[model samples]
Target: MNQSMFIVWRESVEALLVIGILQAWISQQSQSHRLSKFLWSGVLLGLLLSGLLALLIMFAGDAMSGALNEWFQAGMALIASLLMVQMVGWMHRHGRSLKQDLQRHADQHLARRGGLGLMLLALLAVSREGSETVVFLYGAGARLRGPELGLFAVGGLLGLVLSALTIVLLHSSRRFISWRRFFALSEAVLLMLGAALLVSASERIGGQLLAMNLPEWVYGSVGDALWDSSHWLNDSHGIGGFLAGFAGYRATPSALTLAVWLGYWLLIAGWLRQRREEPLPCLG
Candidate 1:
């Protein structure tokens, strides 16, 4: 539930950020009211696009059965994990210039195509964020059902509310929490969620592999638990369960799971380091 909440919160915040940028630009235009209508229309269309995607995913999942279903879910989880990493990296590189870039594009669009171009711009931006949110939520909550699914839905709704409040707070006062700090903190959490999704994918794949006639060592590495920690912190309940869902915690992890978890963090660390060391572009 927390995973769903966070996913929705983060994605909603990003979508809102894009809309706010476009709206702010439009507010300063000569035909502000005219453009505002197009902008809002675009936003509505983008949301409809995202809703269609969600329905497609749900129907596709329901259509599949047995191993194929597992494979599909695993693939979705893997894709979501990769996208999360990519989003963080892209934001790390482009966040400082995002507002300027949006306004510049808005200017060009309005110049070339008037309100139509502005509408298209807003549509693409909102759809990108909304589509991502749908995929991420599906990956995170694919297995949820009954009460759990209800909670997940509630979490998403609460997240949406929180995001609105968050934007208001940020716009109202930077003294409390700046955008930079918010992004930095959220990036870390996103990476952790990515790890969780990656682990989930690996586990699903491992289950499929285990069912096959694999070599003995392969089974040992993928299926055999190295040690038991459930006595201390059972991953199936309470705080540990939340950690398992949010951060990929394991009470009795197999070698394959451990290897994947470690490799993910190592890659993330190296990527972040390289990004940090890259020289900033020189201004004229």
Candidate 2:
């Protein structure tokens, strides 16, 4: 429930922020009412598309069972992890430019293609985030049952409502939230969550490989348990649990998982540091 909630919140907040920017820009221009209608239409269409995608995920999950199901799940988990990285990185790099980019897009599309272009742009933007949310939550929701699943849905709904309220408040005040800080905090959380998903996916894939009669040696190397640090850093309880849910914390990781985790951090962190240290262009 918590996992789904956070991802939903983060994704929804991002989408809302985009819409808010569009609305704000439209308000400042001529033909503002036309632009508003186009934007709202885009949001409505996006929500319907999201619902359809969610249904597709449900049907697909139900269609596969047993080994095929495991493989499918493993694949989804891997995809989810990769998507998380892409989302966080994209947001970090483009967040500051989001408003400007959206405004430019609105201007160009509004001038060239009119309302239809605006609708298409909004649909594409919202659907991208919406579809991602569907895939991610579907994969995560599969691990829960009964009341847990219900709670997860509740969490997602609350996240959407809260995000909408936030957008409304920010719009009314005409004050942009600090996109940099918002994205930074969310990116950190996502990085950790991606780690957890990666570990889970790796373990699942290792299992599938074994089931397919892969050499025991391959599985052994990939699945060999490393040190158990659950005693000191239990991912299932307290703060460790929070970290586990937000970022993947493994009490016992395979050799491959450990190496991959370390390598991923080193590469991403190094690049981030370099980017941060680079001198900014002096404005004349």
Candidate 3:
């Protein structure tokens, strides 16, 4: 449930940011109301795309039912995790410029295609996020069900509505949430979620490799339990469970899981530290 909530919250927040950027730009333009219509159209079309992607993934998963399917699923999980990490990194590096880029694109479209160009710009922007959300949610949902899934969906809906209201408030009164601060806060949480997904992917792959008749020592090395934290704080209840869902906390994680998780954080943290130390771009 926690995992689902975080996934929805993080993803919904991102989607809202995109919409907010477009909406803000439109407000400054000569034809602001047209922008709203284009925005809604893009949103509806993107949703349709998301639904189709979800169906395709389900059909594909159903087709692969044995060891091969497990391997495929594991591979997909790793891909999704890596994509998430890349996404968060990109957002950190470019979040400030994102609005400018969108506005520039919108202007270019207006010059070349008039009103139709606005629709295209909105469609492309929303559809990219929509497709990604569908894929990531499908992969994550595979790990949860029943009450947990319900909670996750609810959390996502809440995030979506809250974000939308925030935009409305900010636009109307200029007295609501500051997006820069919000992104800064959410970025760390999103990164942690990415790490959890990576760990889960690695473990799933290890299990598949073992079942495929790989040598006992090889699989054993990958699966060897590093430590058990279930006694101290179980992962199915309270704070531990939330951490487990959001950050891939395992009671008895394998040596590989521990190694990969540690390595990922070290690399990301070091890169960010380096970026911080670097001089700002010269304006001359």
What is the lDDT of every predicted structure here?
A: 0.91, 0.77, 0.73
TM-score quality measure for candidate 1: 0.96
* Per-residue alpha-carbon lDDT of candidate 3 for residues 147-240, written as tens digits (9 for 90 to 100): 8788778866776676566556645663554566556666677677778778878877887767666777787768788788899988788888
Per-residue lDDT of model 2, residues 1-284, tens digit only: 68887888889987887787788787888888977898899989998999898888778878999888888887788888889888876765666667778889988988899988888889889999999998788656666789978988998988888777765664565456544445666778887777777777777777777666667777876767778888898878898877766666778877777776787778768867867853322111
Instruction: Show the lowest summed lDDT stretch of 10 residues, model 3.
Output: 275-284
Residue pairs with backbone atoms closer than 3 Å in model 1 (clashes):
none
Residue 54 local lDDT, model 2: 83
Pairs of residues at least 3 apart in sequence or in different chains that clash in candidate 2: 192-246, 192-247, 192-248, 193-246, 193-247, 196-248
lDDT of 1 at 77: 96
Off by over 4 Å in 3: 27-35, 166-177, 278-284
Give the RMSD in angstroms, all C-alphas superposed, for model 1.
2.5
Model 2 stretches astray by more than 4 angstroms: 165-177, 222-224, 278-284
Query: Can you tell me which runs of candidate 1 are displaced by over 4 Å?
Result: 277-284
